[model samples]
Target: MRERKAAAVRERVREFALELPGAYEDFPWNECVIKVNRKIFVFLFLGHLVAGQGDSPPTVTVKLAHPEAHAHALSAPGAVPTGYGLGRAGWVTVPLGEPGAPDAGLLCDWVEESYRTVAPKRLVARLDAERTAPPGA
Candidate 1:
């Protein structure tokens, strides 16, 4: 049941990540990742998608370049710095389907932040422009 819930949340987050400009899915190192312009912005772990793959929990790892956002994300239960020295660079892993876990909205915001951090400046600017553009204009 927990895995099912986590998978649902993971799919929601994945869909949100893919909506960003230049964002696309990739499988490197046999792991799922969402990248923009050749740089990985989000790493998604298995969440009931492949049963018996392992005993690990479902989680999403993203780089929080902003200091306050980084701290806020770490405050969530089961949230932690991403390993393999990525933690030193402000990457955080947020566990899903757990108590005190952040909601899909917050996770999607972080994914956008991560996208802004790694995507080219032009792409980032384009995203910003699109956000501020008037409706039907």
Candidate 2:
């Protein structure tokens, strides 16, 4: 049912985040968290694991740089400002299972942006180089 579908979505998003350079997952508080350079960039939560958060499962809480991007992301369905004073810093909770949740592409984009915001400058440079470098060189 919905739980199965949501689990699939979690796996796909996990794969996408781990594909980024230096990204890895950790089980802090038993919740799946993706990190880059030892800094948490993405958090995946389901069920009451995110208790009191009021957000649905298959949710990704990410950090954003610009207010415009934060505002734009909040405009999407099932998207909400992250709680615990995090929203002031452009963090948002985006539900992947909602009827109008952002597509895979946009979510990945948000993940990338969050990574860029938190990762060390050297690591970010490495990521950019990989993207700009010609194939096989």
Backbone clashes in model 2, listed as residue pairs: none
Error of 2 at 115 (Å): 0.3
Question: Which structure among the candidates has the greatest lDDT?
Answer: 1
Highest TM-score against the true fold, candidate: 1
- Give the alpha carbon lDDT tens digit for every residue of 13-89 in model 1: 99998988889999986778999999999999764332343566788999999999999999998788887899999
Q: Residue by residue across 1-137, what tens digits does model 2's lDDT show?
A: 76676677777778899998899999988889999988899888775655565655678888988777788789887687888788888889877666676767777788899999999998899999999999999
Against the reference, the lDDT scores of all candidates come to 0.88, 0.82
- Model 2, stretches more than 4 Å misplaced? 52-55
In lDDT terms, how accurate is model 2?
0.82
Worst 10 residues of 2 by lDDT: 47-56
